[model samples]
Target: MSSPGFKADAAAMTRAVQGFEECAANAKKTMSDLENDLVSALSHYQGSQATAFWQLHTQLQDKMRVASSELDTMSNLVNQSFHNYGSGDSTVAQSLTSLSNNVDAGGAVFGRLTGA
Candidate 1:
């Protein structure tokens, strides 16, 4: 039977990871900018209404941070998977090559002994 094979578009995977990382970075930057703007706009405000608004905003920001973190983690995982697959594929190929070489040498020795 033929050896199993693996094929992947490494360039596409790379681009996907890059895109995820960029999105994460953008999310973080946007959150920071939003926070700055909110603080500036609310600086002159006061009262329980403002406090409630800030609390809600904080919760929203926390969720956004989580999302951004998740994106970054996803990107890292994809990149890691790509590398691992590549390494595993190379190892399998080398093992197959070595096994084939050994079989060839054995066959040659057998032929010599049998005068074939």
Candidate 2:
């Protein structure tokens, strides 16, 4: 007996991909904006504290870049998954349709073992 087949929610997968992409874009924009604001704010004052602040800013910027890249990777992965799921669903549907056609043509759904 055949059981119910797999059901994929393309809309949900698309939304997830979009969400990741949006998050990456937001991260990039936030980092850029913050960097600009910090640069404007620290335009003057030469001191050890200013040097340390710049170092910290660089580190933060690097971290944010990494985060954005990771988010983009995730989005790509989800998008790939969506395509894979669609392909798999198509394969299964085709196989089932072939099977139904065979059965309709009076072919056995299951082959019996002659030795058994």
Candidate 3:
């Protein structure tokens, strides 16, 4: 078989990745609103079992938040990496510093969410 004569388009990939991150951010916001509504609805329950279930769900809220933050951080880090390689520009040492900071931020966010 002959070798394929096609190459991945970096610009398109970068655009798509960035767009995906934007979508993820919007999704996180929408999920937060929905979760709030769920919690509000949970408060109206009138049984011990229902109250216990809601308490358990409330306990998991922190885990859910951490997961969402991690998702967002990873999305941002991947978007930056995509742009860096997609541009095929490696000579700018100064910009590498910024990229390094972004990666560090992503790592830190794994432990806890921070102000965006």
Candidate 4:
């Protein structure tokens, strides 16, 4: 038979083991919660970043379209002016000069639109 003192020590040891198990379980749960929170925060950040990038891309595309149209108009006007000059018509020459001025104005507008 075990001595009374030895029985008491054994009981104390059992209590200590139970306490350690409880603490370990709590720590594990806390770590899991922290991991989940980190993942959620990262997902939110990625979503926000994607939205911003798409918005910027759309705005850039719109600007590019406007710039392209302006360039096309200018090219057409210049071509018309050259054709008029070749035709040796004084009235056409005057018209060509007006168109050239318009082209210059459009160029300035395009530049402003492109932030250039």
Candidate 5:
């Protein structure tokens, strides 16, 4: 028999993954806001310092964009995984069912052998 807690555990894990995605989204948005603020700051400068500052900010911005994209990818994957989790029809569920069936069959065979 499947543990009654299996569903609860799955639900907990689903919540955790959603929390991960939420935190990532918050980080992405905060980084984007920071990028915008830096861009505004970049516009009010002049000469050599401005050029140097622009180069640094541009490099940081590119890296931030990549980080945001990665977080988006993480959210997609986690959502897919948790969708499967909630269905009670994931690969893990199937495998558990198969194992239970096998165990039952083995017990029946053993019972016959023992004349029970």
Candidate 6:
């Protein structure tokens, strides 16, 4: 026999979990699309154009790889932060802040690489 408050809390938890799953799915889809676009762009370049394309592509790839690694690291940090939060650790707040800063730095690098 659950109380009304307990049922409400359970519902809120379900919604939160659903939201997290949706966000994760969307992020995965976005990454997949970006990868596909890069592949398609490379495929379109051939012959003499391929040389210049390869050079630019390689540089962009390196930048993207670094950005990707940073993003992954930040994501892990965020996950850890959440875990810490669940465990009632105050350090999680600082970890979240650090993760935000790292993400901003990575975004700046990505922006420069994309000239945007």
Q: Tell me the whole-model lDDT of each prediction, alpha carbons only.
A: 0.76, 0.74, 0.71, 0.61, 0.84, 0.67
Q: After superposition, how far is residue 96 of candidate 3 from its true place, in Å?
A: 19
What is the C-alpha local distance difference test score of candidate 5?
Answer: 0.84
Better structure of 2 and 6 per lDDT: 2
- Cα lDDT tens digits, model 2, 1-116, are 22243443655666777787787778778878988988877777469878988887889879877877787787778788878976776778789999888866654433432332
Kindly list the per-residue Cα lDDT of model 1 for residues 1-116, writing each as its tens digit.
Answer: 22333444555666777787787778789888987887787776679878987887788778877877787788778779878866776787789999988878899787888899
How would you encode candidate 6's per-residue C-alpha lDDT over 1-116 as one tens digit per residue? 44566557656655665566566656666766876787788788889897787787677667767766666676666566555444442355568889998878899787888899
Descending-TM-score candidate ranking: 1, 2, 5, 3, 6, 4
lDDT for 57 in candidate 5 is 99
lDDT of 6 at 95: 80
For model 4, the stretches where C-alpha displacement exceeds 4 angstroms are: 47-116
Residue 46 error, candidate 6, Å: 3.6
| Clash count for each candidate, listed in order shown | 0, 0, 0, 0, 0, 0
Better of 2 and 5 by lDDT: 5
Model 3 per-residue lDDT tens digits across residues 94-115: 5877888887878857556645
Q: List, residue by residue over 74-95, the lDDT tens digit for candidate 5.
A: 8888888787666654666789
Summarize candidate 4's per-residue lDDT along 1-116 as a digit string, tens digits: 44566557656655655565565556556655655565454455557786775565566556655655665565566556555443444555578899998878899787888897
Question: After TM-score superposition, what is the CA distance of residue 58 in candidate 4 from its true location, in Å?
Answer: 33
TM-score of model 1 relative to the true fold?
A: 0.70
Q: Which pairs in model 1 have colliding backbones?
A: none
Query: Against the true structure, candidate 3 has what lDDT?
Result: 0.71
Pick by lDDT: which candidate is best? 5
TM-score to native of every candidate shown? 0.70, 0.70, 0.55, 0.39, 0.69, 0.45
Clashing pairs in 3: none
